[model samples]
Target: MPKMVFIETDGTRREVDAPLGLSILEVARRHDIDLEGACEGSLACSTCHVVVAPEWYDLLPDAQEDEEDMLDLAFGLTKTSRLGCQIRITPELDGLTVKLPGAK
Candidate 1:
């Protein structure tokens, strides 16, 4: 099983199992992490926004236009911002790390 790290809003680092094929949002939900995927991976909202660690950001596939549009509405967006639902776990992304944006 591959592993991934999630940096919570308070800066806690959590490493959790990331089953292949599951989206980052799914991984967060599985671990009880506080990622509010309001649209349930439908790409309809920005509630599942996550800032990918700079080191791991380029490893992800580029965001499609729709995801980019939704990300525009995300709070605390960053250069590496991504919608957690749009990224799926793969062998190349075994140690992915993302930061939960602070709440509004």
Candidate 2:
């Protein structure tokens, strides 16, 4: 089984099982992480924004224009920021790590 880590704003690290094919937002939600997918993974909101660890960022597929646009509205966006709904879990991303953005 694949696994990933989510770092909270308060520096807590949560490692959880990451089912293949599910979006990061889905995984977060399942584990009771605080990511708010306000758009229900419809790519209509930036509430699920997350910062990918630099080492894992390039492993992810490039975000689509719509996701990029939504990310622009994310609080505390960073060079590795990505919309959680835009990133799907895959074998290649087994050890993925992302940080929750600071609250707005």
Error of 1 at 79 (Å): 0.3
Q: Show where candidate 1 strays beyond 4 Å.
A: none
- Model 2, span 1-104: residue lDDT tens: 89999998889998999999999999999999999999999988899999999999999999989999999998898999999998999999999999999722
lDDT per residue (tens digit) for residues 26-101 in model 1:
9999999999999999999999999999999999999999999999999999999999999999999999999999
How many residue pairs clash in each candidate at the backbone level? 0, 0
For candidate 1, the lDDT comes to 0.95
lDDT of 1 at 16: 99
Q: Which ten residues in a row have the lowest lDDT in candidate 1?
A: 95-104
Q: What is the TM-score of each candidate against the true structure?
A: 0.97, 0.96
Error of 1 at 104 (Å): 15
- lDDT of each model, Cα atoms only? 0.95, 0.93
Q: In the order shown, what is each candidate's alpha-carbon RMSD?
A: 1.7, 1.7
